[model samples]
Each structure stands twice: as structure tokens, then as C-alpha cells.
Target: MFAKLPLIDYQPLKIIDIAQVYCTLTHPHFSNQIITDIDQEINIIANKSQITCQQSIPKHEEELKIIAVVKQLLTNLPKYSYPKLSLKFKRIISLPGKSDQAIAYFQTDLLTDSISTDLIGGKLNLTYNLNSCPLYFSLQSALIRQQDHRLLPALAFEGEFAYGNKDPREILQIINNWSEDWLTFKEIINQGFLG
Candidate 1:
């Protein structure tokens, strides 16, 4: 009879590690393929968290919650100049050969002073162009389609956080606070989808 062995615990794979490996072993359509693979992995991990509520149409209440989060960020930085408010809806071709007509999918745009906070395709993007970085901050939920055509959500973050002479501690604090708020917003969105 063989002795039983203990199970081995493993740490989660980092996105950077996965990217490095993929980049090393390049293949055809590597960019798209890597993204798809990563998305699939994220979806798998997300499903484990019990994302049950999937709806065919995204609700208005959800949008309101997201907007509230952005507004809260602006409110925190009262010293900064008030940015102009603009609401822009982007329409995309829902189906093939429908170039003439397109359905408005995501709500995008919230120009707060120099900061451009956008909600596109269920992702929050904070862009600060005054500094060297173009794409400053981003948070995205790993969106997967349910059998009923609904979507389940998972969270992911991207973008650079670098120290520069142009960005003072106060400005950096605002960005940091915004990121924290974004995380809170993600939880709300997750619950909305799950609940």
C-alpha cells in the first residue's frame, strides 16, 4: 500500500507573469489570443465567487451608481477647478451588415477639470494627460455572457502609477482616492450583477 501525500498549495498566477510567458512564446494573433485566454481565465476565477444574477439588459440603476462614484471623487477634490460636465453615448454595430444603424451600448464621459473619467463597456477609465502618462488609470470587470445572454462580472485593473515632478502629492492623493473609490464601485457593480 502507498502512503497518502498532502496536497500542495499554489499561489495565483499574476497577469504580468502570464503576459511575459505568452510574449516569449509568441504565436499568430498573439495579442487577441492572449487577451481571450486571460479573459477566459478571469471568467473562470470569477465564476467561483458566485456571480448568479445575469440580465440580458443592463439596468439604469447600475449606471446611476457608477455615476455617483465618479461624482464623489470630484467632490473630494474641491480645490481643483470644476471640470465641464458632458454626457456622451457611444453606439456600436450590434450585428453584421448593420453599419447604417447602431445601438448605443455604453455610457461614457465625465470631464472633471483635467481628469477624464469615462465609463465604457462596463469599465471605468481615469485619464490624466497633463503628465507624461496618457492612460493613467483603468478598472475593468471580466464580463462573460450567460446562457440567457446576460453578463457576469469580474474585476481587473490596468494602467501606470509613476512618480513625476509634474504630479504633486496632493494630485497623487486625488488619484489614489479615486482608485479606492473605483474599487468600492466595483463591489457595488459586482453585487448588482450577483444580487
Candidate 2:
């Protein structure tokens, strides 16, 4: 799904401070057994909206361990209905010329009856900092109304990478890697957000 989107490759960039990947599932029930089944090494947080497992960057060899945990969670989910899945990747890049930094936010959401109708899609907002003289840009897809009264099978990738003091190409490379990993993760579950 990400392949179809435009690639972000900007020049004169710097470092990435944060990288986050997340997904949402449609399970309304909670199971303690499923929680127990996860490896103790991963951090699992169960909330009203969803169960989230998060981990900081692991050693190169431990990547598979993280993937394994994600797969296990998906396998335990109920198969009766479609799940809401979302993947987010974020980084902070530094700019050499400016004392202040810029921020960019991007996101897309499917408009369903469950959501408010006033929401708009494809939103972009920019703000400037007078002290540091930096800019912040926010980009997002408007809420696309669903024709049918059901929740549209869709996935949204959102968030922004902060512009810091590292190489721009390298920051994009990291984003690309994370995006590819997300694609592989989706394939492992044999599910696509947009069916």
C-alpha cells in the first residue's frame, strides 16, 4: 500500500530523533491469555481502543524478535471481522543553516459514520516560530466519506519526521526501511487495510 504513495526524498537534511510504527485492530474483546502469550521481552500496553506493543530500536539481530511478537498478536486476534490497522513512522531531522527546526505531519483517515462529518481531508497547515525562525508543516488526507454505511476497509499512515542536523538522504533511508518493514508485516498477517 505504501508503495503506491509518493516517495519522500528531500535534500539538505540532518538527523532523525524518533521512529515509531503502530497499528490498530478491530477486536472489541480483551483476552488475558493473549496478553500472557506474548514474549516477556516486549512491552505490551492494553487500552480501551487497542492493545499496543512498543519497543525501542533493538540490536540488528533482535529485529526478528520484534517481528515475531507482532505476528503473534495478529494470529491471536478474532477472525470474524475486519480490523482497523494503522502504521506510523516518525523521525527528527536537523537542519544546518537554521537555529530553529521545521516539523512536517502527514496522515490519512477513512471517513465512517462513526466519525464526525465535519472533518475535512487533505489538510495542510504551516506555522512559523519567530524566536528561532523555523517552520512547521502539517499534511493530512481529508476524511473521505464512505458510500456504504459500513466501516470502509482502509489503513492510514500518519505522522511526521522532525528536521534535525543529520544527512537528509540518510533520514529518508531510515524512513524507507521502516515503511518496507511495515509492508512486510502487513503481508505476514495476510491482510491489507484496503480490501
Candidate 3:
């Protein structure tokens, strides 16, 4: 019977865009042949959200792969072959219905980076850096209506995080555990406090 209560039946918001995974590998151990092999075969994996690289590794070649999480997809990129590399991951969350006043829902303090224009609605972009670690978090607002017959405002917010200078295995583990992190992030954002 309690299921009917408005508060009890509250449903959390959902992300609209597929997560994009990214990675950047830099190490002195990479051999010229290994780099060339990875560069030559990197194009075969076309799906940005679910990337997997399969290449022939030379003798003594390190089996290193960085699996980055974007949205809900897992990207397995071959990194043992590169001496320097970087990738970007992005995900978007949106709310439907009358979002005419959606900009007001966001807090001002969290608007560390913001842009406003007459063509589109207000936007907020936030960035957080772990001073001691090689990791950073970024959030941005992308609220614009698309060209459609029906009124569907693209009241969306994007969240992204990047990390570097870590072991490939450790990076993979973090990517595998990102689901829980995503859940916690969603909950925190839903509360209208990105701080």
C-alpha cells in the first residue's frame, strides 16, 4: 500500500547519452614495433562506446589494455603499444517535460564554469581535481531543444572523469568498478548539489 506514496515511488533520473570511454597511456617501455602494430590495427575497433583492440604482440611485448567506461559501455583499448596517449569519456543525463525553468533547479555555487546565450538555455560546467592523484571530474549542462514536431527540450547534463599515470591492470579494475561510482554520482547530482 505504501508504494502509492509520491515520495516512496520517487524514480531517479536516467542518462540519455551512451557513456564514452577514453584512455591515455605513456611509458618508456613501449617498443617502436609495438606502437606501429597498435597504430596500424587501431581502426578495426570502430565503436567508441565498446572498443576492443586485437593485435599481434611481439615477443617480450607487454599485454597492456586500458578499459575505460563511458556511459554504460566498456572500451578496451590497447595501450601497451603506445608511448603516449589520451582518451575522453562522456555521459549525459536529461529530464523531460516542461523544463522552461529547469535552469533554476541548479545551484549557483556548483556553477564553477557557466555559459549563457539567447539561442540556448543556461549552462553549468564543473571541474574537480584530486590534487594528489592524476584524476579529474567534470560536469556540464547542455540544455537545448532539438528540432522536432513535439516539444522535447534537451535538458541534459554531462559528467566526465579522466585519469592517467596508472597501471593498465589498475585502470581496468577502476573501469570495471565504475558502475557503482556512476550510481553514487547520479544520486549526488539528483540532489542538486554537485559540490
Give the lDDT of residue 132 in candidate 1: 28
- Candidate 1 Cα misplacement greater than 4 A, ranges: 1-57, 97-195
Model 3 scores a C-alpha lDDT of 0.38
Model 3 per-residue lDDT tens digits across residues 1-195 = 001112222134434533334443333332332221234523224332233333322222233232212212223335332221223333444445455434433332323334333323455455545332233344444454456644433335445545545555566566566545445445545554422
Candidate of highest TM-score: 3
**What is the overall TM-score of model 2 with all chains considered together?**
0.36
Give per-residue CA lDDT, model 1, range 82-170, as digits (tens): 22221111111111222211111122121233443343344556654534224344544354344798543323444433323232344
Alpha carbon lDDT of each predicted model: 0.28, 0.36, 0.38
Off by over 4 Å in 3: 1-17, 25-99, 104-120, 129-148, 193-195
lDDT of 2 by residue, 43-138 (tens): 666544455555544435345354455555455653622243333332223222212111111222223345534443334344434231132433
With candidate 3 superimposed using the best TM-score fit, by how many Å does residue 160's alpha carbon deviate from the native? 2.0
Provide the lDDT at 33 for model 2: 26
What clash pairs does model 3 have? 19-70, 19-71, 20-70, 24-85
User: If both were scored by lDDT, which would come out higher, candidate 1 or candidate 3?
Assistant: 3
Error of 3 at 105 (Å): 4.0
Error of 2 at 65 (Å): 3.8
Order of candidate numbers by lDDT, starting with the best: 3, 2, 1
